[model samples]
Target: MVDQAELELFRDNVRRFLEEEAQPHYEQWEKDGIVPKSFYRKMGENGLLCVDQPEEYGGIGAPFEFSVVVLEEAARMGFMALASNLSVHSDIAAPYILHLGSEEQKQFYLPRMASGECIGAIGMTEPGAGSDLQGIRSRADADGQGGYVVNGGKTFITNGQNAGVVVAAIKTDPAAGAKGTTLFLLDTDQDGFSRGRNLEKIGQHAADTSELFFKDMKVGADKVLGRLGGGFGHLIDELPRERLVLAAMAVAHARGALERTVAYVQERKAFGQSIASFQNTRFTLARLKSDIEVHQAYVNECSGKYQRGEMDVPTAAMIKYATTELEGRVVDQCLQLFGGYGYMSEYPISRDFVDARIQRIYGGTSEIMLEVIARSVLGR
Candidate 1:
């Protein structure tokens, strides 16, 4: 279990880091449609990235709670772009290397990733496949040199545009179905690797998501992560962490949005009185606050279980689905409370609304989460 003192320290460190490093440039990055690579390097310098990675890899090797702190603080500042981006690199991508990469691969990549010298991304979603990992059509043919020639495209890849390396999923034997799926550490600078335009998203406008194409992209056998034909197993193993991280972000986001709305209602006047004086406003805020507290407690409990390696896929999926959907609803209600100003881009709630939209879609969709939960309940 995470102690209050440690959690407090982590909260302080992340809050300071954001105030000093991230917040100052957030708006400009949003306008530019991407954050600079230097920003990520700065985070590494501050030991802000990959807190849970091993100490040998230049990581702090802190518990999962540290990561939760970072995500919560980032979300509180309305920097979901930064939170989501780092979650992909540190929480999602790094584990693949740590658990599956060879010793040489770890030594070569882990330090660079820890120091933000190399930005990492995972390519699992294809144009034809979103939650259906089994439907990916990217192929990798044996090159007879113990390597493979990769060819296909991936879309909606987080960190796609700026990623120095991508853990790409491809089928080495089409007849093998999910068993044929393999993972490769494809260098973005490789000859046949290319990225499409940075997707203009409805929310999280500052995040750098894009389409990736690999046309005859050559990757070494050494770059293959984990055992051949075991890609599905590896993904399944790590998905609990991924889903937990998403749940943490969701709870934090709803809390932050609700807090902002409360402050607004207390100060903003309506009908010759503070909006907070209205029974409607009082009931709405009361309900949101209670809901947020309930979710926060649940998520915190899950975070503890996750640190102890006791969390399961079904529980993670449940929280991820519930919290993200709650975040979307809370943010929308908060925006409505903001009246006309909420619709204006000048209000942080406007961006918060946009940024919160993708939470239910990514990190496994709400529908997918429900399926996982139902299967568990039904003893499947």
Candidate 2:
């Protein structure tokens, strides 16, 4: 765990890196439809990408909170596309290998992942499957030579275009429903692995969402991640951390919206007075500020629980659902304060509005989260 002084120092470094390395290029990256791969390497060199992995694996051996610092600072600075992609690399995919992979797999992947020589992505969402993992058609069949042949496709994969490796969910037993699922660690350079065009999106343009295809992609027995038939379990196990990450970014993103809107209103004038002087403007901001702080507190509590390994699924679901919902509302309200300017693509709030939409949809939809909470409440 990083001490308060060290964490704050790290935060300062992250802020400086974003301002110097990311902010100047963000608009261009958005126009390009993807962040350049070179930036990831820059991040790895700066010790900013995966701060938590052990030093032996080319990391600084910092705690997971260090990774959260990266996530929160990026989102807080309105570089949410970067934050979204980094969360998958540093928070979700790398941790899966770190925690569940065999020592050999760890030895090969973790060092490279930590170094940004291997960008990581998680592949689970399929074209036909949204919230229901059981509905996925991607499958892996055992070959006669102790390897498995994978044939399936994944869509909306974060970090997909630049991914050097992927931890993917595949159905290993078509007849076994949830029990049939398994995870595999794949080298994206393999002959049978291919990538489709980077998908266009309404927001987060630089995040590099892609459609991935596998046709007779072969992997040895050593490529299996976790148990062969435990993919869903692995997904579930990792989801709390994943969802918590979403919640944290939601809070930070919303706060960024508020901060920018605050500056805008104070300078934006109407009726011969600064808009911030208006009662409506003051009250709206006051309300959002209050709500944001409250959510921040709750997120802080849950985050501590997560760091202590005490966070539960239902609680994680609640925070993710609540914070993302708040994010949507916050951006909408903040945009309204900007009046016509808010609708312009040039305005930061405009991007904040669109980028926040997927936060609720991905990482499990808001509706699915409610169902998870309901089940916990009813013990069903």
Q: Which predicted model would earn the best TM-score?
A: 2
Q: Give candidate 2's error at residue 126 in angstroms.
A: 0.7
Per-model TM-score versus the true fold = 0.98, 0.98
Task: Give a tens-digit lDDT track for model 2, residues 242-317.
Answer: 9999999999999999999999999988999999999999999999999999999999888789889998999999
Clashing pairs in 2: none
Per-residue lDDT for 272 in model 2? 100
- lDDT tens digits by residue: candidate 1, 189-303: 8899999999998888678999999999888889889988888888888888998898889889888898889889999998899988999889998888899999999998988
lDDT scores in order: 0.89, 0.92
Measure candidate 1: CA RMSD.
1.1
Model 1 alpha-carbon drift over 4 Å, by segment: none
Evaluate model 1: give its lDDT. Answer: 0.89
Each model's total of backbone clashes: 0, 0
The stretch of ten residues in a row with the least summed lDDT in candidate 2 is 1-10
Query: Lowest summed-lDDT stretch of 10 residues in model 1?
Result: 1-10
